[model samples]
Target: MQGGLEFKTEIELLSRVHHKNLVSLMGFCFEKGEQILVYEYVSNGSLKDSLSGKSGIRLDWMRRLRVALGAASGLAYLHEFANPPIIHRDIKSNNILLDESLNAKVSDFGLSKPIVDSEGSYVITQVKGTMGYMDPEYYMTHKLTEKSDVYSFGVLMLELLTARKPIEHGKYIVREVQETMDQTKDLYNLHEFLDPAIGLGTTLKGLQKFVDLAMWCVKESGSDRPMMVEVVKEIENIMELVGVNLDANSTSISASYEETSKGNSPYPGYPYS
Candidate 1:
């Protein structure tokens, strides 16, 4: 009975929300205690699969950045554009899916809750989210807000850069990245932390900017974090810096991803080690 209620809630939420970057609900089934949600088929599977090497497809630097932007756009829409403003309480890589062209689409809204502006800016409820991706403030105060999603997205950004799980071998990726940044003031040291498969040594400037944005999103205080709208703008700027013309057309971005992946080493003369 309780499971049925949760399913109804998710259906009610997803049915009313529509965006290019969010998974579209096709239909649902609720017969004989069997409940199911039919969503648009996303061929590329979850972002977690891509990062964990289970997808069999390599997400190069450009692809990763594009995925990040797409996810951010979806979240921005949910927080800013959606009626009543929805908060995706569970914003983790596993919930972010990709299509055949590798375009990201946020999915799994079972834990989502609508923000009642009248009650307050935040919804005080039981903290419900994945372990590694949950926001500290939300966990501590049980005050859920859009910023909690930002914090989880920050962890997602780190996963994209490092191609590592949020928690590997009992070590938190965010803490590790923060410690590394604290120790090394030079951006050149970024190569040491970034995923070697992307061959991102030449893209230091853009990567550095992305790191800065991620750090801001994961700040201890929700007030310190940038809004989702700001996050989208920053990602757009980063895409621009990387010469990705997202406005051109889908074909253009696809071609760019192909070309960027051709040369194994995006930076030939630059030192990778």
Candidate 2:
């Protein structure tokens, strides 16, 4: 899936879009049936690595928030500002890379689609994406929309908090978080779910709001999800609440892409202002 048509598509799409939070395409080669795309070397590994403790980069709450903001800013630009607009069919933590500063850069555009170039609002096509991060609605009806990415991003948000894979040991993070969440208790009674490195029983400003927003994005239905632009605003507001500079940046717990898909899934208007 990373060569030929998909490879060229990735090259073309990356060539057209440029953003600080997006991995930059340096150059490429496609002669003699050989294909290569050279992108700016993002020093730090993927967000998945950091969260899994494989990258050895301790992610505190602020750094994690900044990483989330950077990824959201990149997606917002793709969904709103790209000339023809784009929908990243995959939005998992693995596709999010980090630079030396630990600022996130959205990578792996192999599955990106120009939402506006298609027939209209939503592009109807065979759904292709990572197992845990695929959108339930998209997987169901094959209608790829901006909100699909939102759903996947919601899962990524949960990954940030829990530092757990979307699905681990047959337990889906979305369902885990959904069942564990109890608004009546302190920290939503999510101490067990939260990554201890984020600190324990300490006053984590904006933690509740952050959890609420993540749940909102993962609503079972796409329409119930917030637009990427709206997500950016919410993150920015959360950052401000957490005392991070608003000037700087930027989940129901939908059923597993497995369970719902085994049973039962719009594009966006461009130039949202």
Candidate 3:
């Protein structure tokens, strides 16, 4: 009965969401008590495959930045534009699909939930998410919020930058990065942690900003994390600084930054006085 409820929830939520950066559901199947979701085939496979060398294609630094931005845009759309803002309870590289052109499309809506009340900041519910990507606050309090996704996405950013799994040999990547940042505080030393495949020759300033944003996202308290709209703008700024041109689609997205910024709280329900 619980499985049926979850499947119905996914179908109901995903059927209403339409975005360039989100995977589209073409159809589904429920035969012989077996359930199957049919999503548009993403030829390039998952982001996890691309980063882990499972996929033969090597992603350059520019392409990786584009992937990060594209994924951020998709999350921003979910948190801000969806009718009843959806929360992607599970966000990880494995769930991020890549098209033939390397455009990112967030997949796997099985754990997604909708925030039915616009005024409510969060929903109290049983926790459900991957180990490394789960938000600490949500894990502890069982109060799920949009910021929970921000924390997971922060882990995703660390994965993109370091090309390391969230957990390895009993060490969490977040702790490793934090300790390194604390010890060195120097960009030169930080390079040692970066994924050598795409990190070579990348601008240090841009990398620093990216790392900073990721750190902010993973802050202990959800109140400290930037909203998804802020995240989208920050990534755009980073890309522009690194000399990447904003495409027609991204240009339109940039325009919304200001309008969305007006009176929006960094922490939901805690507007600026």
Which candidate do you rate higher for TM-score, 2 or 3?
3
Rank all candidate structures by their TM-score, best first, as comma-separated numbers.
3, 2, 1
Candidate 3, residues 1-273, lDDT tens digits: the string is 457877887788789999999999899888899888788999999999999899987887788888999998899899988877899999999999999999999998889988875566788889899988888778878889999999999999999988898988878888778767753466635676788788587554487788889988988789989988888888989988988898888867856756764122234332111
Total backbone collisions, model 3:
0
RMSD of 2: 8.3
Of candidates 3 and 1, the better by lDDT:
3
TM per candidate comes to 0.87, 0.89, 0.90
Where is model 2 more than 4 Å wrong at Cα? 117-119, 247-273
Cα lDDT tens digits for candidate 2, 1-273: 355878977988999899888999999988888788899999998998998899999999988888888898788788877867799898999899999999899999988898764465688878899877777778878889889899899999999998988888878887778878999999999989999987666778988988999999888788889988778778877887888754421221111111222111133321110
**Candidate order (lDDT):** 3, 2, 1
Q: Worst lDDT window (10 residues) for model 3?
A: 264-273
- For model 1, residues 166-253, the per-residue Cα lDDT tens digits are 8878888877777677525666355566787666546444888899899899887788898887787788788888888777553243
The per-model lDDT (C-alpha) reads 0.81, 0.82, 0.84
